[model samples]
Target chain A: MLNIKNLHVKLEDEDKQILKGVDLTVPAGEVHAIMGPNGSGKSTLSYVLSGRDGYEVTEGEASLYDHDLLDMEPEERAAAGLFLAFQYPVEIPGVGNLTFLRTAVNAQRKARGEDELSSGEFLKVVREKAKTLQIDADMLKRPVNVGFSGGEKKRNEILQMAMLEPKMCILDETDSGLDVDAMRLVAEGVNALRSPERSFLVITHYQRLLDHIKPDVVHIMSNGRIIKTGGPELALEVEKNGYGDLLAEVG
Target chain B: MADTAVLASKAPVAEKPRSVLDARLEALDLPRGGFTAAARADAADRLNAMGLPGKRDEYWRYTDPAAFNAPTAEPLAFTSRASTLFDEIEQLKLVFVDGRFDADASDALDGEGLEISTLAAADAAGDHWAADLYGKLETAGQNPVKRPFAVLNTLAATDGVLIRVTGKVSRPVHILYRREAQDADVTIHHVIRLEEGSELTLLETGGIAARSNVAIEVEVNKEARFHHIASKRADDAKVGIGHVFARVGEGALFKSFTLSVNGSMMRNEGVIEIVGDDAVAHIAAAVLGDGTEGRFHHDDTVFITHAAERCESRQVFKKVLKNGADGIFQGKILVKPGAQKTDGYQISQGLLLDEGSQFLAKPELEIYADDVKCSHGSTTGALDETAMFYLRSRGVPKEQAVVLLVLSFLADALEEIEDDRLRDDILTRLDEWLTSRASA
Candidate 1:
């Protein structure tokens, strides 16, 4: 459901090229894991797709379900069914978590020409969804991500994903700061949302997260381009041998 | 009034350079008759000594006193607000039209554990309890710093209310001001006393007139409680200056909060003295100024003194400005020699929505006691970019995101309101203003 071809991007304020002619695609109902070392542009790909600022796409194109993703604003992209789970969730001091969730949900609904949920209906659905993610009433009442533990923030992100129900989900290092149990909970949340009409693109540096989510395909990226593509077992190979051997083999 | 102004200008005092103070007093009309005649005369003498505030004055450095010192208020097109604060709550309502008490619109001045009288009526009587307290606290407040406008208000205020509380008042007293004349200039003074072991809440709202000067002198006696909530309504061309001078006795509690929306110029000053041990006092304000609608300038100045041991005082002020709006804050906390264990906190913050807007703040603390804990902080900044991106990424529109951030910035000042319903009402108004302007 997501496609990218020759995506070349660079820092908008400086003369450094980040992503050099990267190309990849993930089809519907499948989870793809992108494994890469530092400065490989794994995170930059997600940011470019999500329409973040401070990055200029000099060449190439990215699309979601035939819709031009880079042509829309951040909020417009979300209404078009693209979600990015951030590695670090922001702490908004006075905006209550539940209030934020409701606003986001209603805003998207309005943009899509759908009837917005009333407060009562929203509370019921949110409570049910939050129960699965183990987010308590207090967390919902508190300000967004303020004073939240590391695991709680990750789970909160997953909760937002469930609520939004995007067509394409991109997890940018969701497992970076999570413990073993927290990682399992997050993976379970992701696995539950898997459907034939939905797709997943997971960018991570470790196979620990792949152990629970079980990706359908694995891609080894180095120097801003995907160099190797294979089955899920490819992740295990990289885990055992490391990227040093893969770069040498490619050379 | 013009004739009166002319007559006052030709007074016996020597004419020296026709200074701003002299020119201002020349244009002002002093009250001719009142039960406060003696107090008015005394205040007039003091006012002449101090003179009208000049831009050169230390306290007036950040804000110009030219508008306030002008004799005639500039005319404005009056537009009634859609709703009034405290509309849902049942209470005693006192209405004033351009500074004159509307007896027909006001409720009967009789209630449980309370005594209320109009200053005009009290002036006709020979003796009254208010005569003893009227302008007393204000006279005491004019020390270490000069507040010539408040002194001028005492001598010029023609009508107001005098309230006395002997026990817990069942319902709050609501004072609602309304303006009809476009160029109305009004001066109003109120004196309130809470006797020992008594409690009372006072609510005020509306922009009294095109130009207004108001003063409320409050005395919270031993073991008493006094709560006040007021608002300066959005009037694009309104200029208002208000003051509250209060004295807290042993174990008493005093709290005051104000919400100010768009105005041409507004200056609210508070002078509080905690006299008895263990008393508590708090003063806070949340201001929203948007110069795109009109010329917006707001200033909040406060001075609090701790004279007794173990007393606590707090000053919190927050402002949000955009489109070239200007905001100023000057606050100070002073602890006396024997006032050990005094706890005082002060914070003033401004969130400027655009580069054109500006905020100026001065926070000071002086402690004669070695064992006091007094801290003050001031900051001015724009909205957090990372936080803005976070909100926008979640499908919240840019305008809605801005409204959320502005409200968040003002939450600290709103938290000072003790009543949930009142606080919520103020929050609703703030939200409505931000949403409408953001979309505009």
Candidate 2:
């Protein structure tokens, strides 16, 4: 569902290279996990894929199916069935949560040339989805992410992911601020969306989150490139021995 | 009526060269044979005392008063854009073209608990109830800050409407000002008096003229309520100055909101005095300025005083500027001695769409009461980048995302409008302006 070949990225404002000739790919309906040390360019890959500003791609290409992902705008990337669950969800005041979701949903639908959902239809679908995520009416009525707890923000992000039904999903440290129960809840929400046509690239720093949403393949990233790829047991090995032995073995 | 020379002799020494003020005054003639004759003469004396505002003047520092100081308005092409803001609401309509009341186009000035008359007709009657209120509130509002243009408006105003409400008015009084003259230099003064236990809503829309000075004096008695909503949408080359002076009595409510769009130079000043206990006053404005519309510069200046115990006052102003447009806000809230438990709040914010645009704000709070709650805040910023990316990543187009963020930035000022329908109407128009600009 997603492919990257020798991607290189650097900061736009500074002379700092974030991602150096990294290469990885995730097939359809598969879950792949990439674990790395801090400042190892895990988050940079997600940002560059989502078409955020202040990032310059110096080399390589990435694509979803036949479409060149780097050439599309963020909204176009989204309309092409790509979703990124942010690590720190932005708090936008004065914009109602329901209004934002409705706008986003209709926007993508319009971009894809699909019939827009009516208000009543949208309410019904959102009500059903929010119930599973344990988001109440107040959460939907308030301003987007403003005053929400960390767990609530993560759940809101996953709820958005569920509503969009993207073909390729990237979770960038979604487990960073969540507690045990919140993590379980978020993992269950993500797991519920796993289908034969959907794929996930889960980026986490711990095996604890992987325990909830098991990955088919685990990759160890050091510096800017992935150095090792193995089964789920690799996550346990990293949890026990840490990246010290893995980085030394690669070196 | 007093002659210009006699009034000038009684005036204070001109702060600047007297040539400018003298030439401006020499070009205008005060209305004769009116009940407002004595009041107009007093105002003329006051105007001569203050003279025309200079750039160095304290209140005029942010906004240049050169346009108002000119002897005649620079000729402008009349715009044909008509406002359909309050057409859906049932109301009494009054139409004025080039500052002259149109008797044929206006509805009959007859309504239950309402007495409305043109200033010219009322002045011809020799005497009226508004005689006591004529220019009284404007004179009271001159303290702490001298508004020479408002004084001049009261002195040389050629026509306006006089309204007095004795009981609860069932419908709003809608005043529509239309411009048909290119070189129309217009002055209008309105007097409104609401008796005890009465309520009224006044709606004003459209542009007055190429250059206009408009003032409204409101006297709300005990337990009365007054709501004023005005929208100014003039051509890009227009220059206008508007002032509202209100005195709210015990247990009364006074609220005023304005929406201004697409003006070259516009200044709006509001002075509200709450003299009775438990009175409430609110003044708010939303400005949409685009410098592409000919050197856009808009200013909002508000001063509210709490003189009685437990009085409340609020000031909310928001501006959205783009393409080098300039927006200025100067607001002050003062709580007098013995006005215990007074609650005053003021917030002014500006959103600059580009780096070239600028927002200047001055928020002040003066409190003499020991037990009072007062807060003031002012902010100038661009749209939030993180929020923008979040919306765009969620699939909203860039232009649509900008409109959403701009509307969200203005929601606070729009909330000050109590009527849901009126607020919705203003929101609709604002959205249209933003959408059209985005497409362009």
Candidate 3:
């Protein structure tokens, strides 16, 4: 459902390339895990796919279900069923989480020419979803990510992805700051949202998160390029042997 | 009719008080002969001795009172009939033009547990409360910088709406102060009193014409609750100045919201004092100014926990400046000694949409007690670029994105208003003002 062909990107001011000819593809009904070391362009891939500014796409194309995702704005991409669970979500003060969520949902619905949800119906759905995610109603009433704990903010981002229910989900370092319990809860939430027509790309540096959400494919990335691909067993092998041996082999 | 004509024809008598000090005392038509006359004369002499505040005054530094020369509008004639701005409000309306009350257009409340009459009529009925509380909250000696308008309002204001709610009243009170023309100076003093356990919602809106030098005073007793929402939508040719003084008693709750849309030069000075323990006061304001010469200034001061413990106070202000207009917001929260456990918060934020637009926000907190939680924050900047880009990338136009961000910036202040109707009305007015200003 998601495809990236020889994607190359660079900083706008400097000609220094960040994503050098990276290629990836994830079909429906499967989760693909991209494990990389620090500064391997995993987060940069997420930002480019999510249409964040300050990065120029120098080469290749990214498409979501036959649509040109690279040309769409961040919000348009969101409406087009592309969701990116950011490593660091923006904190919007004075804007309540519930209000922000509703606005985003309604905006997407309006783009799709669907009827808008009433306040009562929206509140009911949000309450149920929040309960399922173990998020308090008071948290939903507060300013978005303002004064929220690290785990709480990550969970809030996951909650948004669930609400948006995108066709392609990109989890960039979703397990960075989460504890064992929080990681388990987050994995469970992601697992529950999996479907035959939906796909996910879980990008992380550690293999601990891979134990909860089993991936069908594992890819190793270094120096802004994907160097190797293997089955789920490859994740276990890397966990035991580490990336140092693999870096020498790639060289 | 004869009274109004006589006052209108006596223009030379009004023009004699040119200086700020003389202008204030002469604005009020004090009694010619009586004990009250001598007392008013003494008060006027005291006001004259104080003189107009200069730039050296700390509080008046940002706003120079010397620049605003005293207005010289002829006193309104005695007309029992006058028009109103909004007809949907059914309550009795008191009309004051150039600081003179129109007895014909006003109504008196004479029912049980309720007293609604003119200040002149109430004083004639030997109501000592009227005289004692008239200028008590706005003592010239105490607040020397911003009391010139208050002093003028006290001494010159002939007739005003006197509302005394003894018991719980269900209906809302609407006081409409309509400025007829911008030819001369005018000052109005409106006093409201709510007895113990009384509840009221007062709506005050300025008229279409420009009004110079207007002041209103409100006092709430113990256990009383009041919600005052004042809106100003004046024309560009008019210059307006207003001051609101509120003294909240013990256990009483008072909330004041002021919204200003368009004016040539406008200033609103707000002072809310919490005297009784456990009293609460919430002051919120939104001011919008545009055009080359349009300027708006707001000075809000709130004193909580004066003698009462555990008092709570909040003040929030938002301003939008465009074109060459200027907006100023100065808010201070004071927690007096012995006022323990006081909770106070003050925030002032402004959005400057153009290069020539200017905003000055000063938020301060003075606490004498160590066991209190008081904080003040001020921010003045353009719209958030990331939020704007995010919205624009979603197919939203740039203009629409700006409108959304501006509205979001003002949402916090607007949410403090409890009445939905008033809130919606003010939002609509703001939207219109923004659109027109942008187009211009």
Candidate 4:
């Protein structure tokens, strides 16, 4: 469902390269986790795939569902079924969370040549989806992430993911700043969306998130490239021994 | 009427001026006759002393007062026919034609707890309640900067209205201006008084004249409430200057908001004084000056005084400028000595769409009471880039996203409106304006 070959990305304002010669692939219907140490280009990978500004793809190519992801704008990418749950969800003052969600949902639907949802229909769906994540009515009424707690913001991201139902999902450090109970709730929400036609690229530095929503395959990312590949047990090994043994062995 | 028309047809062309300030004022014609001798002399003297604010004046530095201070202007035949707002509900409609009350087109003035009459009618009635309020508030509000045009309006206003409310008014009052001739200079003055525990809402719409000067004097007595919402728009050739002088009594509430969409030149001034303890006042404006042929200039000058203990006041102004348009905001909050526990807030912000457009803001706060809470802030910037990206990433197109951000920036000022229906009407017009702007 997602493919990247020798993806080289650099800071748009400087010569520093964040993602250097990275190659990875995730087939349809599989959950793939990329475990990496600090500053190992984890978040950078997510940003590049999501078409964020201030990043230059110096070399290589990335595609989703065989579409030229690198050629599309960020909104076009979202319309093409790519979702990125940010590590730090944006706080947009004055734009109600419900208003933001309805606008996004309708905009994507229009771009996809689908009928827009009426207010009544949209409100019903949002409320139902929000119920599973414990996002109360008042939370949906407030501005987007304006006064949200850390866990609430992560869960709000998950709620958006459920609403959009993208084909390829990227969760960048979703487990950070989340307590054990909050992490489990987020994992449950993610696990409920698993389907035969969907895929997930879970980028995390810890294995606790994988405990609730197990991944089909695990890859060890170092210095902007995937250097090791293994099964779910690989995540446990990294959790127990950390990245020191793997980095030393690779050297 | 025939004689007036003959005089209008035979009007002499205003000669080239050796001095802009000297050649004006005495030439103006008051259609409804003049005010009391002393009152007119006082107003005219105050105006002559200040002259017309020049570009060199500190308060008028950002905006040139040349258009407002022009020596002579020919009448213009306005052709645009725009619909008036707040027509969806029941209202008492008062129409004015070039600053003269059109009694034939106005509604009957009969309502419970309210006494409304035209300025001409009130003047003809001989001594009345309006005599006490006619220019009292205007005279009391001229402390820091004297508004020469407002004083001129007080002296020369042809016809307006005097409204007094003794109890809750069920319906809003609408003042409609229908312009037929261009280059016409109109001076209008209105006086409103609210007795103890009374309430009122006043709505104003339309372009009054090509060159217009309006003065609104309001008094909110103990436990009274008042709301003023005005939306003014005009083409590139029009110039309008308006002022509001309001005094709030003990435990009274007064709120006023204005939406200025398009004009060649518009300067709106608001001066509010809270004299009674526990009174509250809020004055806000959302202005936009966007035009195609030439720059649209808008200025909002507000002064709010807190003189009583535990009184609260707020002043908010937000402006959006584009296509070389210019916007100016000058506001101050004063907390008088012994006015302890006074709370005041002032914020002025501007969003410039292009480098050619400019925004000048002067926000000030003077506090003499040690236990007061006061804060003032001013910012001039482009749209928030990060917020723009976030909205665009969510699939809202660039234009729609910008509109969202702009509307969000103005939400606070819009919230000052007390009536939901009136607020929604203004909001719909604003939305249409933004949509057309996006296409243009």
Best by TM-score: 1
Ranking by lDDT: 2, 1, 4, 3
Better of 1 and 4 by TM-score: 1
In angstroms, how far off is A47's CA in candidate 1?
A: 2.5
lDDT of all the models against the reference?
A: 0.89, 0.90, 0.72, 0.85
User: In candidate 1 chain B, where is summed lDDT lowest over 10 consecutive residues?
Assistant: B10-19
lDDT (tens digit, per residue) of candidate 2 on B9-63? 7455453635688888889876873789998889877776667777877788999
What TM-scores do the predictions have? 0.94, 0.93, 0.78, 0.93
lDDT by residue (tens digit), candidate 1, B368-401: 9999899999999999877787777778888989
DockQ rank order: 2, 1, 4, 3
| DockQ-based CAPRI category assigned to the predicted complex of candidate 2 | medium
In the range B12-81, model 3's lDDT, one tens digit per residue, is 5534333555554454445432223444565565455445454555666666665354434423222222
Model 1 per-residue lDDT tens digits across residues A128-196: 999999999999999899899999999999999999999999999999889999999999999999999
lDDT per residue, candidate 3, A31-128, as tens digits?
99999889888888988998878899999999989789899877778778888887776667666788678777777887778898999998988888
For residue B323, give model 2's deviation from the true position in Å.
1.1
lDDT of 4 by residue, A1-251 (tens): 99999999999999998888999899999999999899999989998898888999999999998798999988889889899998888887767899889989998999999999999999999999999999999999998998999999999999999998899999999999999999999999999999999999999999999998899999999998888999999999999999999999998
Q: Enumerate the candidates' DockQ scores in order.
A: 0.70, 0.72, 0.21, 0.63
- Chain B TM, per prediction: 0.94, 0.95, 0.83, 0.92
Best by lDDT: 2
DockQ of 3: 0.21
